[model samples]
Target: MSKNLADLNSLEERISALEKIAENFKKRAAEIDEKGEFVYENIADLKNCGYTVLTIPKVFGGKETSLYDYIRLQEVIAQGDGATALSIGWHMGVVRNMYENKWNPKVLAAVYEDLHAGALINAAATEPQTGSPTRGGKPQTKAEKIGDKWVINGHKSFTTMSVVLDYFVVSASIKDSEEIGNFLIRKEKKGIRIEETWDSIALKGTGSHDVYFENVEVEQEDYVETLGGAKRVNPWLLHIPACYLGIAGAAQKEAVLFAKNYAPNSITGTISELPSVRTKIGELELKMLQAKYFLYSVSKKWDETKEEERELLLPQLSAAKLVVTNTAIEVVDLAMRIVGARSLSAKSPLQRYYRDVRAGLHNPPMDDMTIGQLANFSLNKY
Candidate 1:
């Protein structure tokens, strides 16, 4: 193994240990509603397991796992539980932005220290009117430069892990500059407030909420540029797809087991013996298989490339997210169908999978928008 891969492997033992503990919380996960009311010791256990800091570059004393390892880690953990994986997804995503932008030495060091200290980080990018960055295709929050710091005032909704996260990478427009920038808002900052508004139909434990920033203050150095200027082609955004694929694969596995055990009201045999159930299960497996390969291939493509070859890979990576997320939703829906009315219950694993995976469709550069962009690029050639 390379030095980086070797370093990242150490995290698996710790995280896997935490997953074993979190297994006890699976049934209780749906009961915890609202953002602040949903805290589990298992999440804290993740900190104890050395999970909150793996993304920092080596200069900052972080393992800086390659995209291949990072996504792989997410997939394994996600298969065990979806909400935990969804909550941690943002932390990994922002740390990736840090890598892409090539943060200043001090910035990297500070974030690394924060992570090691058990601080959870997340991205607060979606607003009520702005739709989602994944959908609207751009940022709507505003960052005003005043004095030595930028004062950010906006409302971001659906911010995952809002309760536990110590830092938020907020997407806001530059006040007078008419430009977009991401401001790192500390949870401890004076003007920032979190509204416990994330009561959803699924992924109830993710703690996604509405965050209100009534002039949150940050130094110029704290801002991470994601769009418009000096942006790095972060292949790390690929982590989002990893989260969805994990849920899909888990659901696919669950559906098979349920079919083997389920007894229909009229039929004397297990559902697995039914021809219809077998057909749907086959379809779900095929989609999951395709999705898994697409995700791994894209990550490996970049990992094997020179710095000069990355631009050539972005279109393919974007296509991977579009396909994998869509496939996951389809595959999980098929699982729900196999279970029938029982799957609609609050207790069924398929219900959460059904709702949580839809977040992928609404996730940044929305699928419709992505298709449009892809078509534009491809059609212009003909």
Candidate 2:
């Protein structure tokens, strides 16, 4: 683990640099998708640019990026490469959790160092039997306290960036106790292996695979967070929608470019001359504007609001995720229609965008669940 010169410049400069770097990934992104390989180069680029530790608090030798700033940068990255943006978003979000003092002092110190060194950590809470831990299913993974170390064993699904993660925050039930905790395990330890199980057509380069832990030993203090009761919607997690929104933006750009220049032998002019094509573009723009307002305003609200007030904003956050993700999907569909059959060709990105945007529908704070929660709130108020 080493440190880079803290490029303590203006936030705008930092964001602009990252956006430029992301733009460079477009070709690489297509290659990664075609090969169905991990976006290893993309992660390495982010690390080299010192973007990996941007969220660590200033006091802990990081840029201390604001939640809004984080989302804004992620959108830029996603616009260029959705899989890379998504893979790193999990790392950025989980590391930001440390700012809330969620981990013990010793653990926090070690984590800060690891993160600054460009290490990635993700919460491996999704299990085969329990699905997403957010659904309140008990984890089949168990940890036993033997002497001074905690021995952990279990399987995790959808471990995004498993190939590059240096550490994992794994949730496990204590051997004898009813309590569950998040154990921090280093990747170098024995008994930890990546299962290479992810074969999804969407986000093919994310490298989200199954990980198995067999008798992995961790220090007592490594159990950082208890798998406690339900928690409030984290405003930082808005990065999820930010990623999808970027994908939508990319699709819109592709469609607009094609419309502006595509002249056919049978047509009198380019597609941009067609009223229907213009209308679809207009719709995409309107939806994007609405989604951006919803996302940024709520994110700003989260930053300004007190922690207690933040808990009550679950509906707004959930709505932002639902609206943005749905809007992204629609935008991609429109892009595909505008581009016609060519959009579906493997050479075109619109098809990939269509597939990737749909994954957002399955992300946490699911559409149906959000609607139900909103209805529950409205009914109680009414």
Candidate 3:
């Protein structure tokens, strides 16, 4: 008999209990799809495990879980299947943005209720010209007011989990006003097209395809919020870190495994026995520890602090994403070094992990931009 999670006597206890299964999911994540597919067959079970609802606030049918718990949970999910974790992370993280929005009470309730019911979501704000929405650009997607409705026209690229997302938080420019707004777009809507154009070397299975909207009409009331010329707390963007955290956590775990099993015939022992290998592992371990702690800490802060307090931490959040993703790439490379040519095989996960971890640095506030921001902030101080 399936148990209603709402009926659990102690939700924390149940989540802790569920985390154990999440660990199992992580280990079996890659093993489940040796071919590195991304349709995410396990997404349903992820909800059953209480992951999809974990980020939601209790007031809106969400657990409104602690930030630390959210980060840890993301790590668990990512460890299983990097692509799957990366795919769902954007949607799960966006729930926080959704709660913070001025969406209609009924729409908000409906969204969360389904999240509680084990559904996933995806935010579609990226475009072909602008790239990941985090870079901050005027969208090519235009939404024109047409009588009682809005006609949305444009293509969105890198729409992760577009197939399974209950709805997309699509971004577009308001005609006449030159204002930017985000609206809730449903898959069933007419004139909305799903294009299978996700051709990437990494995260191949994420199905982050190009989406075409041709006069797709939407009600005015469904508009989530107006982005309105660059304000603080960009609601349409709140993932990246969660995705990289999972990959970093996975890399760390892989590093541990390699360190334990890598016996080299040259030393008549495991390469892990060598000081050089251990030194590399040590470098990776330290970086992983730092990134993991930063990711979890920031997530918790996001959950607890008032809106004002969050602004001061944006730079820190950017740093966390940059560091975590970079560390994941570094850590995975170190692990591959321990395994040598063996890790280069198509059969080896090291190759896939390598490509996947680098994706973090490529997405959202690009590493160069983050570095530039850090530099600018430092230069302006004092």
Candidate 4:
């Protein structure tokens, strides 16, 4: 094992290691975006650095990083490459949720072992028919019980990290029942295939391909949890905004650097000295500061709050995601304005950041749902 991988025992060590690798990620960011190719090397680097297992419980031989630290780590990774950060964030968030919410222990153990062995995982929930799962649409995917095995047949869309995931917790409707369940399907299972269907302009390297399960069989025990179970708050979803915030941070850096160096004949000095440029930079800083405080504060509160009290935090959690994600988009826009037309150049990182940050809007807990929830809560409370 590499020395960096061995030293990932604490949050600080992991952060340091991620920072070291992010420079290399930045160098390849444009190429990955241009080709819309998944950077397998970036994923490998994350695994080699032990970041892939950061959310697993300590008893499972993992880092058990706190929610706050996990968000911080994600932000740092996003600074280098938003696509890589977003792709990996799904794995991290899913793992954290499983452990926190207590998924099937046996399955969790088996998956943790795979994670230690450089395997990745993510939920395959969204489907072409259901649209965003957040809208409470029943999955079109169907699972049938055949003897001791359950045969799953369905197509899952937006399966992030599809190319590399070792396991997919697929949501499917149980045949002959009104029930929906998440089945833990291994990648090596027979009758499983991935269709390279992802072609989004934003976060193009996420490799969120379409996965088909035709007569895929799993042990009944692999049926992990029922869908639409009592809703429990998930603070880990904040990783979504954390990823975008990191992209915005990268954009902010690019803008600052460009302003400090690019001297136009019309200016006495570099534009960094211009009041207008300074104002935009200041606005960028303000937005980022607000976003960081909101994200980190909520994550910290989640870490400190009791499990039973966590349900009450749903509104705040959704608000944090909403505020931070929108703030990140605004920050990137301001950053591009600071850099002028050159920011849109295919060679410029700002263009990539601009495109990547927009993906956060489409992530879980949609803006409309969050707003409606907040309104409901306010009306009831008052």
For each candidate, the alpha-carbon lDDT, in order, equals 0.75, 0.87, 0.72, 0.89
Estimated TM-score per prediction? 0.86, 0.96, 0.88, 0.97
Model 2 scores worst on lDDT over the 10 consecutive residues at: 1-10
Error of 3 at 178 (Å): 0.8
lDDT, candidate 4, 1-382, per-residue tens: 2445445566677678789898889888888888989878899888877788778888788777889998999999899988888889889988877777678788888888988888889999999999998888999999999999999999999999999989999999999999999899999999999999999999888899999999999998899888787877778888899999999899889999999999999979999999999999999999999999999999999899998798888999999999999999999999999999999898888888888899899998999999998999999898
Q: What does candidate 2's lDDT look like per residue over 1-382, in tens digits? A: 1223147466577667777788877878778888899999999998988888888887787777877878888999999899999999999988888658468877888889988877888889899898877678989999999999999999999999999899898999999899988888999999998999999989999999999999999988898887677774677778899999999999999999999999998889998999999999899899889989999898888888988777888888888999999999989998999999999898998988988898998788788888998998899887
Better of 2 and 3 by TM-score: 2
The order by descending lDDT is 4, 2, 1, 3
Sort the predicted structures by TM-score, highest score first: 4, 2, 3, 1
Which candidate model has the greater TM-score, 2 or 4? 4
The collision pairs in model 2 are none
Looking at model 3, residue 357 earns an lDDT score of 76
Which candidate do you rate higher for TM-score, 1 or 3?
3
The prediction achieving the highest lDDT against the true structure is 4
Using TM-score as the measure, name the better of candidate 3 and candidate 4: 4
Best by TM-score: 4
For model 4, the local distance difference test gives: 0.89
lDDT of 1 by residue, 214-267 (tens): 978899898866456433466877777888898898788778999999886899
